[model samples]
Target chain A: MKKFAIGFYVAVTIALMIWGYYQAIYVAPDEQTMHEAQRIFYYHVPSAMVAFLFFAISLIGSIGFLSFRRNRPDWAQASDAWALAGAEVGVVFCTVVLITGPLWGRRAWGIWWTWDARLTTTLVLWLIYVSYLLLRRFAAGPQVQTLAAVLGIFGALDVPIVYMSNRWWRTQHPAPVFGGGDDSGIKDPTMLAAFGWNVLAWLAWGLLILGLRYAVERQHQKYAAQEAQEALNEVA
Target chain B: MTSALWTHLVKDLRIEWRSREAINSMLFFALLVVVLFSLAFDPRGAFSQEIAGGVLCVATMFASVSALNQAWAREIRHQVLDAQRMAPTSGAELFLAKVLANFLFVSIVQLLLAPVFLVFYNLRVEGNAWLLAVVLPLGTWALVANGTFFAALSIRTRNRELLLPLILFPIFMPALLAMVLATTSILTGDNDPTLWIKLLAGYDIIFTTVSLLLFDVVLHAE
Candidate 1:
């Protein structure tokens, strides 16, 4: 079943990618201002959405780990695995967002970087999760789990504040062009179709990657437990 | 509960008063920071007033971290924390007491540093003095609340001095940003200081409440 699922995911991903490419290139209308360069938004926005989705998952996992770890070790392990997987996958997509954002900006705004509110907040968000991963790496033993969990909660809580501060700090970047209230939106159905297809494809890709990463985490945990048991047996 | 809180607060204050280690070092460190800032840039230059708020806030934050590190290190080194843990007092009481002690220490340092900053930076406040008065305590309380909590969190970690700041600075960014903007507005005579003050107070309330509730989980973690 697992192998079948993997095959199905790969097939769907390939099919969607083919359709997305066709739609982006042949079907979508040229953006009024940015022309061809604006197409990067199709990939950039979805990556950001996926990163946020994974961070939310990590937050849930952190909360679950903290609340249940004392009474239910199995649940504790599962939560820890989920958190580790979520962070790893979240960082991957955040990196994509960081990269694609600059590429799009350079084409549209004629600059590689600006301290725009959304950009600044995204940078900070990236830094917070990076630090979260570092804390997990440096703080060893059973204590690391609880410490990382606490940090995770704090990091997630800070997201809203970061967004608010940035929004109020300054407005250097352009406002959202989609769902940006009634004033903005894509009128071209073909452009919307292209964007929609790419978003669905990227979301599926993100989940597939998350599943593989989660499996790796669980296997690693099992191996570590086995090694500890063997060491104890040898000592006895 | 009040008695327990008072006892812990007094115990911490008594220790500091006897040794004068944390407060003295923090004060001297802050002075050195100001001096370094003055040396790094010409105080009479156009940049002085514009950057002074940032400089003051950064210096205070670094010194507060040192003070907070000392606060926890002494207790951990002497096993005082372990003893306190074994005591019947609740975690919230102990946490509040520590936060209060740290808050007082940080506030005093800020008070001393403000005048020195004004003298060295060759700057004047154009806004109401009352605004400065309001910004200082709210800002200090926000810093100390998180500082105390993160200090405790990093206590058991290796290389805690490094770890505490790494964990803290990013988390404290929003509060620090608000405080800096508020201070700058007061110095530059920006017409409205209301928004920045509200941000600082809101940050203080949110973190203090969250820390109070979650501190016990941190304390009892294995």
Candidate 2:
């Protein structure tokens, strides 16, 4: 299983790297409004989508852990590792979105950043994941895992409400040059196809990262158990 | 069932009454939160109805979290949960007793401050102040139900105080939104205050019901 994961990771990295390069160079038209800088959306949007997908999976794994409560500690740990890796990638994507988003906003809306819906929710989501990682570091053992699992489940539930309330509030209380308007002229077929391909590439990258992280977590758990056994033997 | 329920609540009250430590600390903590909030947004802004409403909601939440952490943390630290499990009380009775105790504490804070908030904010609350009496219990029910279960989960972990908010902020968003919107509308005197009230009531029902059903699984999860 580990070998298969490693092989798959190498193949996916090569494929995505090539596809990303191709999309950037050959396709994805130069932005008429913001010129070339708008191209970052190709990577940024895909990263956010993939990260959210992994977060959803983490919730599923948690529910499974709660219901089953077997010797499947590895599965629980794997899910945690997947979530961490996804957040790592998502944060990078969010960073690009945060940086280039403001740049794009400055060009289009005449402000570096606006306290608008998408921006605020994204920022909050970033904080939640940071806290999630911190919680894992602070808490360990079965009880800690259960607490983190409950947290993961609840945190995922918050995402939609956060998005909805922000949208509602933004519409009601408008921010300068931010709220009110969706001004994409047309959804060109080529751009749509490019986006589809990029999303696929991003999903592939997410799988590889999750797999690598899962392997590392499993090894760490095994090593910890071995040390405990050695300590018990020494005591005996 | 009634006797079991009575037993749980009576035992808890007896234990709490003996120490009075938990309740004292919780009350002080709630007061500290309110004062800090007032200071945090003062001079530049007096505690208007809007500010008062927001502060009251947040302070209640913080106080509930602080108190719930102590309630369940003490149980695990002392292995009282095992003793309770072996007692003649059912899980439901135990749950109900915890909920009642938490509700009583939170309500005391809310009641004591209700008039003070009105006076400080320079506003008259009309159209059934009794309505809030109904709303507070329902809201407290939801918060305490989930708060107890999460508190149980957090008891043995390190940095539990930090973990509680991280896990809670998301679960409590719906309640927070409902409470704020309902309270704001009530203060502003909307023609259809029923809408926000119904939303708050619905949130309370949904969360409390879900938490009650899940409390058994949580209590035994370890």
lDDT of candidate 2 over A81-128, digit per residue (tens): 555555555555556557766766666667777766777677667666
* DockQ winner: 1
lDDT of 1 by residue, B1-222 (tens): 799999989999999899988789999998998889888886774478778988888899999999898888888876888887888878989889999998898888888888788788878887876888899788888899998998888886776777888888889988888889888888888657788899888888888998898888788777
Name model 1 segments beyond 4 Å from true: A234-236
Worst 10 residues of 2 chain A by lDDT: A171-180
The count of backbone overlaps in candidate 1 is: 0
Question: Chain B vs. true chain B: TM-score for each candidate?
Answer: 0.96, 0.86
Q: State what share of the real interface contacts each candidate retains.
A: 0.56, 0.42
Q: State which docking tier applies to candidate 2.
A: acceptable
Q: Judged by TM-score, which candidate is best?
A: 1
lDDT of 1 by residue, A166-234 (tens): 788886776787777887887888888898998888888889889888889889889988999999999
| DockQ of the two-chain complex in candidate 2 | 0.37
